[model samples]
Target: MGNQPSVPQPGTPLQVIGAGLSRTGTASFSEALRILLHGPVYHGGTQLTLAASSEIRPLMDIVSRFPPQNASEKKLIGNLLKQRLDGYAAVTDAPFNGLIEELVEAYPNAMVICTTRDAESWVKSMKSIQNAVTMGFLRFILFPIPGMRHFPDFVDLMRKQWWYLYEAGEPLVAETYYKHIDYLKRVVPEDRLAFVDVKGGWGPLCKALGKEVPRDVEFPRINDSQAIDRLAKRMVQEGLKRWSIGFATVGVVLMSYVFWK
Candidate 1:
């Protein structure tokens, strides 16, 4: 562990660790976990926002310091989480997928949920949400600006951690997906791990977690491609609005100075 932070005492409040990749119904699983556990569940957006915050900036720094393939890196990451995420009941998506082994070590008794889908379907889902047009627009336009830059940077780091940023093709992503699943199988004990498909719905999940399946509420399915696209467009519009205001203020100041002179 290089310059490792102090490890806090293990706590039992965080009882679930989702070792699922994105585009594998992580968004849905996150919501369901929250409901099942009756507590907050951390997702990719949450992780990204946390990574960008000044207080939690060290999380990303620590991530950059470790090579993903290093076995001891998991222990180091587990120690870091002991300090960083004390109150969360569960976690899902990008960063967790990358650090499943570490998290399992951190919360040894926590239930590990490995949600997966068919490789072809997973690839399709990833391509749908990570469309070139939307991602390129954000990467080129909003991310270059001062205030908006941190978020994209954080997301980029997460993508790199998940091996999503620069793979040769879809097959690589599919391969990584299966690799993660296999890794989970190897690391997590049989009783502690639950391998599931989102299409299987609440039965497997509820059974795994030993939670009562709510009869009235349907399972959640969130963060679809259309929803993500809309969110990106909204963010871009907001960035433009702020930039326009800044430009107008500068123009007014320049005009006032010239007139007075």
Candidate 2:
């Protein structure tokens, strides 16, 4: 926990909770949910880019500190959700996957959507997107400087939540993925939960949400490997630029001091 606050800021209650793992069309589902619900939908991208700075520590603390088995942690979990996730109508990916139990407790009436793809496909996608992104960040940003290993805020959160926690390799990845799905199945009520594949498109999702399928719009398919790789490269370039600027500033300061002396 970076900074522990006693209470979180109030926010609107959530209406939908996505219990899906990454590479399971979470981005597409987030887009669709935003459109259908006519409100903000939190995704991994949202976690990285949009969430308030104060919220991040509590999120990390809650996930790492409070295992569901501990009865005392429930209140802390509720407080964390209310503080961090109150206004979002829906939440998916990264941090949210690890908080399903707490989310369901906080929003008992909200629908749960568990997106699935074949495990083989999911693993393949993860290798391309997740691994590539992490490696790019490491190679171009952190590895160059021994003391500068901490990532930028969003990437740091992701590193803690995803990569650091589950870096054992493919077997662990598969285990965590299936374990998440199984946990949702066990915890959420049948009526409140919907298991779907992105390929099922609007039919299953719409039916689950009790809304009519949109007449003409095709379902969204986003965050392919190419796009993710491009983002990774952009991040690397940006980090390198920042590092260069810092070095230049330091050199200028040192030269100015020597001249004055």
Candidate 3:
């Protein structure tokens, strides 16, 4: 075979590789994989929501090195990612879609599932989520919070994600959507790839993985347009909560001095 992906070691923890962009049913896709694989799935949106400074610092560096420069570089990037993510049963959403080719080689035995949807709808969905988190008062409100100090790093990652399937000059949303799907289909091998539209439900995906259709379990349908709002709110609330703890401590100390006087 011509440079087939290396066989994963026996009992490799990660088994599902998602080669799809966010807003392409990725949330629902992640849930279905969690159910089917019977293990926790690493979702980019949710993971980022819960990430602290320590996690983001390293992950930011790792994600920024995508579409690796050469074979040696690709190998280095793959090792770095697997070191961090090898424990998860599946990896999906935003940046994973951006790193499909490298992930396939890194996690060789993992079945690749490329989530699909209407291109125009995908474009609109992406825009709504981006605008929710980055535009309007959300940015101003979010930036003042201490927890969102890594916000600039997130913006950098987003820009990199966009250029992975897009260019500033072209900037055609629908066209970019198609290009991403086409890139996935081209990059992943036919035998290893499954094109999944969550609308089609479980049959095609199950067949690709040699899995039984889950009984009494309808395929998941998650509306992720508001996912960013939830992520942002959590960050802000957490920051303010920590700030309040410090403020309260200071107040108690000042009151003690006043009472002594």
Candidate 4:
């Protein structure tokens, strides 16, 4: 049964995997699951940091949270955590088989979803976030030196993330944010895989998941990087102003002390 179609038995919990960008229609899908079926859906929230022992527990716990529901779900979740934390599998260069296996097994009796936005849009959003983070970091390190060059071209910084992706050997990581969609198409039965755009909203998705859309629940959109970037910039500007004022105040106090002495 290593190689079998993902056919979920009726009335079992659903599992959704992948980074948020996978566009699996998680909130809508999860909301639908919670309403229609009492299954607890688990989505991965943080980057996998192999160094922290504390980090591994969260990953393991999330996987373990799924009640064995069946022998298959039990084994699938087990293998998923094993492969996920293994050093080699954490790198993009490693074949994606382990994670793929978990997805296939866990999602068999349940609807599994994966998604990707347009490449250009993904790159733009990624760059905006990266720029804000890197700029903040650079300011901290360089503020003391006084002559260090500041960063230029947030786009270039964004490009570096793509390069890092390539170096990690999953160069197509961004391009194939929807790769799981293809995987689900090829491996899981056509009826099971729901390859869809989140932008299309809840109606089509509810129908695909075999549930009726709730009229009361509007699709809760999240993490729009464009909006996030705008907010990050505003916060950064405010932080800089605060830092500048603090520096000036300290400098004035030092001068007064020196003059008085």
**Which tens-of-lDDT digit does each residue in 76-184 have in candidate 4?**
6756654453321111111122144455664455454444457656555555545554563646633332222222222233344334333322224454444434444
Give the Å shift of residue 223 in candidate 2: 2.6
Tens digits of per-residue lDDT, candidate 3, 39-140, equal 777777666555544455556777777767799989887888787675678888766777788888998888888888898887777666666555444454
lDDT of 1 at 237: 78
Per-residue CA lDDT of candidate 1, range 1-261, in tens? Answer: 001111213452888888877777777788787778777666754444322334335566656644545667666777787666676678777666777767888888799998888987787777755563336556545653453456566555665665532332433466766767777887788889888887888888999888888889898877546555665676677667767888899999999999999
At residue 43, give the lDDT of candidate 4. Answer: 29
TM-score of each: 0.80, 0.80, 0.80, 0.46
* Candidates' RMSD to native: 6.1, 5.8, 6.3, 11.8
Q: Candidate 3 — which residues are off by over 4 angstroms?
A: 1-12, 51-53, 136-147, 168-172, 237-261
Model 1: residues >4 Å from true position, as ranges?
A: 1-12, 46-58, 68-74, 132-140, 143-148, 163-172
List per-prediction Cα lDDT, in the order shown: 0.67, 0.67, 0.72, 0.43
Scored by lDDT, model 4 comes in at: 0.43
Number of backbone collisions per candidate: 0, 0, 0, 3
What alpha-carbon RMSD in Å does predicted model 1 have with respect to the real structure? 6.1
Clashing pairs in 2: none
By TM-score, how accurate is candidate 3? 0.80
